[model samples]
Target: MGTFKIEGGHQLKGSIQPQGAKNEALQILCAVLLTPEVVTINNIPDIVDVNKLIKLLGNLGVKIEKIGKGSYTFQADEVDLEYLESDAFKVDGRGLRGSIMIVGPLLARFGKGYIPKPGGDKIGRRRLDTHFEGLINLGAKFRYSKEEQFYGVEADRLKGTYMLLEEASVTGTANIVMAAVLAEGQTTIYNAACEPYLQQLCKMLNRMGAKISGVGSNMLIIDGVESLGGTDHTMLPDMIEIGSWIGLAAMTKSELTIKNVSWNDLGIIPSVFRKLGITVEKQGDDIHIPAHTNGYEIQSFIDGSILTISDAPWPGFTPDLLSIVLVVATQARGSVLIHQKMFESRLFFVDKLIDMGAKIILCDPHRATVIGHDFKSTLKAMTMTSPDIRAGISLLIAALSAKGTSTIQNIEQIDRGYENIDERLRAIGAKIERVE
Candidate 1:
């Protein structure tokens, strides 16, 4: 119900820090349920989805203490398992997709798990089949209630085994890993999601006494342990946010330095932006995007064909960032086709950019071809509603570089991922105001 009034055409400068990775934090927070000991996590982002997950944990009787800013210690020694069946639990659990991750740990530790159908961005068909199948392979009985719209898994004792997932589902892999960490035998997962988020989760679980190997590869091996201990974990910077900043800087022709980006972990992201002809430089741990005053140009492939940017599984370009990439392409010198393969409906946001005077053709639900204006036309301000998290940020970037005032409604979608976005952008010389 909130809106952002952003006056465009401001040249933003100076450095800004990316928040903790929301996707990683979701998995890591759910891992707290694996151990009865105190688990302290730092660099937690203050975003709506993350906070909702934290509250959900508290509701499940995980003792949560906010030790400091962006830090929390959770001890789940006294959990209320029965609360999982309550109406309140269903309401909270259905609010965010990350809430579904708790099922893995709950089943691992308590031998039972329950989750209502999860909710998240309406980008595409995100299935829970991978999660349930992985658990079922690990000797857990799965049940789905059509009338109740809930999923429940139970087992007298889970026996771990090998499971090659249908796809390298990120959240699904994390869930299965958590469940396997406390099972009775060894478990092997092939074709797993080896993204930084999952890698960090595996590393943290190992530190907490979970016998896990293959931290950065698609195959993971886990041996069930009797118990887990307290551990400390720090999240990597949000790569999606970092990519958005790079797009924002390029679109507005501003010099920006994104701090503490963990450049080694940002595989293929910087290069992906550079392919769009944006100058991305590494300054120690920070990423420096120089102003594109003369405008950037999209580089064609070696065959002299039009550039095409598409998303893939790990190590490939992430689907979450195609929206930002699509928006940044609007100002580049050449045309590029943005293919969001994973999500069926994500490309629909191109209409809003088309309204802003960009030449874009939505080929289908998953593809869009953008012919960059190359600074020939300034995008005019307009009122728009944000459909999802990534689209909202992309629109915000377009608004910042637009010709006049732009109003973005449904900013709550934006807040679900970005932490204090308006305030942070203001610190860097952007004219943005948040109104209720």
Candidate 2:
């Protein structure tokens, strides 16, 4: 496993362009199976998850051409159905939950799809009920083996219908949309996850001839068509990364410029950050942080009371970045409550920060009250292991902003999200190095 050795207490300067959204790119890659013609995709992230998905596609007989750096042409015109039954496919399928999306397109195009239990962050009970529930609404039958941990899906001309999802699941929504776009008749998805990633998926499907409305809201209306034509599209910039950079620039007092950020797509991020006293400047599609004067202050209520930051469904604060926000608040002033309503174990990493001398109260599994920047004189470095992707990056941010050196093992977790993180931080004057 590769590890990152970071020397803390440094100001990061220089501009870093955000990579394509890893979440969106993964689904887009799966959407290549919707058509048999060549589909060109641009702004692909050079990350581990994307690489695995590409390999999975190539195994299924899709032709991938490197038209240019960070650009590719995909043709699933000759996809072999037998490849779906291979152990190689299932092994890679177990790598991430995003792989579950292939079941929809393959079933739509070839009448059958096979997938193992999807794998991703072990944050909490992330159920596939939404995906299966939505697929069932379209007349697809699911067969699975609890012992073998395998799933087989088959259908002949899926018929769409109105369905209400149990919860707003991101991948579940994308998978259902992928399946519904090729099914016959119209499919109206209520309580849909209309996050930017899902919106990008909708736009891509619309470009490919699927009728979808309510791009940024909870209710999504999709008109199922007989086929989807191949089209060229670029994945949007990673807003989650942009938010992380905003948090990092504020905490470390770095004058960093995040380029190519879709500023208009930041629906609730800016307001969310401003509540924490972080001002983001829009410099022509770029977000600049002017060393965030006075670091970050936890803004309280009108009557001088601490505030609570929590997560909800779409149009609300994202649950993924709450860990980063919690970590950043540790370095800010005042006490604030972090209610991670989505995941149970996400905030468990705060104990590591407390070991580093930060003041915090772990109210329970899902809630914590943090009293910030009590100026624990110094944070001594230690050897630690990464838990998950977001929490891993949060720990990295905390370590970088702390004093002394720290060694973080299992950087593969962080690699799943952030691209060339160590190199990027090094360019921004951070004392960080990656070693195998």
Candidate 3:
């Protein structure tokens, strides 16, 4: 575990770049296993979870080469199938939730995939039922062992078919798509997740010779292909990190410019912050948020009801950014209700903000009502432990605006997503130090 010692009440100034998308990197890294040819990827985020996946791929006998900064070529010419049943794999496979995605590609290519119970942030009940059911809907045989605590899927040959998912799970959809790309027939997936990450994965698969239509829509059609080849891919910028920076600038009265933020892909993120009365200026591909020393104000709905910010699927505000919204609202002029619909326990971290002198009502496990302090009362610094990745970043933003020095422990959760976060904040004039 590491700690971040931060001196608060400093107005940050200057530009910072958001790292490559963490979610997309996980999918793209798993996609490399679909093909035996060389697949080159750029803009890979240097984060803990992603590095763990890359190491797992290497251990699986995939030839990985770092061609440049944030660029790598993966060639899966040979894979050790026996490693999946090894003790070392059971430990490494459970390190992150994204590790489960490899099953689809492995099953598609080799007719078998195995994973121990994947472990990640305890945000909510993130079920793997969708992944297993989707694969089972195809020709795959799925089995689980309670004593061994592992899941295994095998198919002599996968035959694609039409199926409506129980939910439009992003990872589930990606897993199924990876499996279906090499099946015998056409696979039509309705109510599929159409996020940019999925769209990127579909495009990369298409570039690798798989025929997938409906790139940006809920309906996806994938035609079976014999084999996939190599292709070059570059990941989009981290939209969650961009939103985090926007909130950080407003809460800390900082003038910050986030460079190359991929404005088109950031659906409803900027507008959601604007609804909270935060100023977001678009300069081509960058976003510039001026200092907010005067404090931000929350806007009421058209009917004049209290503002309520909730998370939904794509084109809806991401559940990942709700924590940042909740933290930023602590300094706004009016009260707003943050409803984290996707995750149940994500709102529990508001107690830390309440301890910092912010007025927040934890209505339940899913929602929090934030009564903005309006900068009239300064938040007192305090020591806190980060509960998860998003909550950790939210606490970091709050600490940047606090009255005195603060320490945040268990920052490994934050490191699992953001790349060199302490160093990046320091480059933007934030008084943050990473202490071991």
TM-score of each: 0.99, 0.97, 0.99
> Could you tell me how far off, in angstroms, the CA of residue 323 lies in candidate 2 after the best superposition?
1.0
Please write out the lDDT profile of model 2 over residues 140-209, one tens digit for every residue: 8988989879988789889979999889988888988889888888889998998888898889889988
Error of 2 at 377 (Å): 3.4
C-alpha positional error of residue 22 in candidate 2 after TM-score superposition, expressed in Å: 0.7
Ranking 1 against 2 by TM-score, winner: 1
In model 2, which range of ten residues has the least summed lDDT?
374-383
lDDT at position 332, candidate 1: 91
Against the unseen true structure, what C-alpha lDDT does each candidate score?
Answer: 0.95, 0.86, 0.94
Task: Choose the strongest candidate by lDDT.
Answer: 1
